[model samples]
Target: MKQLIVIGAGQGGLSAAIYAKLKGWDVLVLEGREQSGGKAGGIVQGDYLLDPGPSIIILPRLYEAVFAAAGRKMSDYLVFDKLPTISRIYFEGSPPLDLPGTREECLRTLKEIAPQDYRGIQDLLRKLGSVAPLVDKTVFSRPYLTSKDMLDPGLLQFGLRFNPLRNYRQMVDRWVTSPLLRAFFYGFPSYGGQTWNSKAPGAFLIPYYMIEDGVYFPRGGVRAIPAAFEKLAKELGVEFRYNSKVNEVLGNESKATGVRLTTGEVISAHAVVSNADKLSLLTPRDGDPGWEPSFSYFTCHWGISKTIQGLDHHVLVIPKNFETGFEELYDKRTFPTNPIVYLNAVGALDPLAQPPGKTLLFSVVTAPAEVKGIHWEESKWNYVKSVKSELRSAGIEWCEDDEEFQRIQTPSTFAQRDGNYRGSLYGPDEPHRLMGLFPLGNRDAKWDNLTFCGGSVQPGAGLPMVTLSGKFAVDLLSTR
Candidate 1:
């Protein structure tokens, strides 16, 4: 049996291991951390379970497909429930807009709130829905190995329907006229580490997926998704070694043989798959210019004493000066004074998320990736105060007294913990993006038997995409 070694037990790494094992490769997964799940992992504070990463679940079919490929049922390992209220959009000085799961309910909400932009939003969804199949076939199903791959006829056809050259703001502006709708649309780009000016019309698919397919939540938590994959992988005879960090990829310029651990132990394999950030492994080649680090997140996890009314499972708070916030976030490379805040109150859906009578709130604000002169160690507490003030203004009030425990994660935390490049949630910045909309390829140009599967690699970030990336990595090995 051919042996394969996978570095990182993240979603992509675990996916790659399972897929490779199914294809008759003996698989071993090495994780730097003590467990699997990578960023999707949660923290336990006494009786409280706080899932700090990836609150919303969309396109659950991607996860289901993984189990299907292994001739197993997904429900047997993980159970997912579709959320009725996807998110409640809060704007300063205005009635909050509640977006229900179904398209009809969403349209109804739109009609009630912004009647003038109703038809425009309807039309936008219609157009995106029409071309969604084409996108899945051309963009999602394959990796862009070369410049010619980008100009593939199928990709060009999809591009015709949705112009990838146009910026995200331009695409949304073409449809909705209301500032509320625009503010909602503007945030999707940041989901993929792009800005409003990023040529990523693909970001529009986010809202389409949410309103059409319905957002889902796993029974346990976001960590349950990765736990499911880890369980399935173990059943399939894939081995996992925790706290075994890889220091380097071992091979020559033409082929990758294995990986060298930080402890100086070298393990050989027929092929190596890396789930680490691609930037950490491969250097920029000709036509593949180096990337500019993208935006990251500033997250605060609070275990409050009481539940806040009107707070849904997912809530997006758009500040009054959101335009200025965007400008400050993207162009100025500074944290927005009035940042758009995302709150995930797991207790809203799952009763067991916290101790009795308490609520676990995970709040996120988009901040620029770690750069010089931005001293998070010194300034993080002040920023936390600002974020709390913003949250108070939006009606979810909490004081230092109300807090059972408070924990925060900055770019520094992500960098040290997950080994993320500059602590970016998504891989690369927009201007120097390796591939305009698509992520870097799964197959390495320098090493023949090395492939990558993660947020930084092909198919882009998010739970579903990273899960799909594992399949892409295995596919490259099978093809070769």
Candidate 2:
């Protein structure tokens, strides 16, 4: 049987393993960590089951597609519950906006909060719905290998869906005048580590999926999603080796042979699929100075003794002056002293998340990837202060003394644990130019047997994209 070796057991790697197995190849997945899920992994502290990363789960249909492609039903392996209240946005000095999952409910809320913009909101939703399919079919489903790919006649169907001239912020500006709503809308680009000024088309559809398609949470915990994938892969006869880190990709001048583990064991395979940070593979020794690192996460996990009231399962605390905050973060390349905070209280949705009467807060602040001047250890306290102040202002409270348990994860911690270049959660920053919007290809141009799948590669980040990325890689390999 043809053998395939995948380095890393992230969503993309596991998905690739499953696809390869389905194609009648013997597959082996090597994961450095004791478990799977990559950044989406969970942490169990005392009575609290904490999801340290990727608290929001959008586009669950994409996940279901992966299982369906394997001739199985996702519900058989995992249970997903749709959230009625998707997200509650808290803006400084303004009334809060509790966004519901349905368009009718969202319009009702908009009419209540910003009555003047109700019709405008309706128009924007229509625009989002019109463009969503184009975005998915034109960019999300296919690979962009060359400039010619952009000229594909089918792209004409995308129409004004993208309207290449307007930035994401500008697109949102066309619909609403309220800063509170604008901030909420503009924040979607940050999901892929891009700014409001990103010219990448298809970003507008983010709200369409969140509001119309619906947001969901796994029944047991966020970790349950990956656990389900891993289980299915195992049942398919794919082998997994935990705590096995690959030190190098063994290759000839023309193609890859396999991977060499840190433990000095050499595993041979017909092809190699890497789910690690692409830069780690590109550099091998000292990284390229020219490559700008992607945004990393500054996460604070707290297990509070009491439940926090007036918070949805997912809550976003928008900075009062969002423009200045973005400037400080993207332009000045510094830690966000007054950053927006995303607080996920999954315990509100999943009873298994924490003990009764207690809350589990997983707070996230997007930060620049690790670089020379910034010191995470010294700056962590300020991040904590910013988070606490934002949470308090938004009417949620957590005290170090009152906490049953607390832990902090900085970029350095992520680097030490996952070997991500400079703790970048995604591979690289989303390119601002239209041409650069397409990520690096799934298959290597020079090495015939080498391919990549993960946040760093084409189709980009997020659970859905990464899972599809694996399929893209496998399809490419199978064609070769």
Per-candidate Cα lDDT values, in order, are 0.85, 0.80
lDDT of 1: 0.85
lDDT of residue 360 for candidate 2: 80
Q: Tens-digit lDDT track for model 1 on 354-400?
A: 87788888889989878666888888998898788888888988667
Task: Write down the lDDT that model 2 would get.
Answer: 0.80
TM-score of candidate 2 versus the correct structure, residues matched by position: 0.95
Query: Which portions of model 2 show Cα errors greater than 4 Å?
Result: 285-289, 430-434
Q: Record all residue pairs in model 2 with backbone atoms less than 3 Å apart, i.e. clashing.
A: none
Judge candidate 1 at residue 478 and give its lDDT: 88
Q: Highest TM-score among the candidates is held by which one?
A: 1
Model 2, position 242, has a per-residue lDDT of 95
Write down the TM-score of every candidate: 0.96, 0.95
lDDT of 2 by residue, 20-116 (tens): 8999889999999899988777777898777777777888888888899889999999888888887888988877778887767877887888787
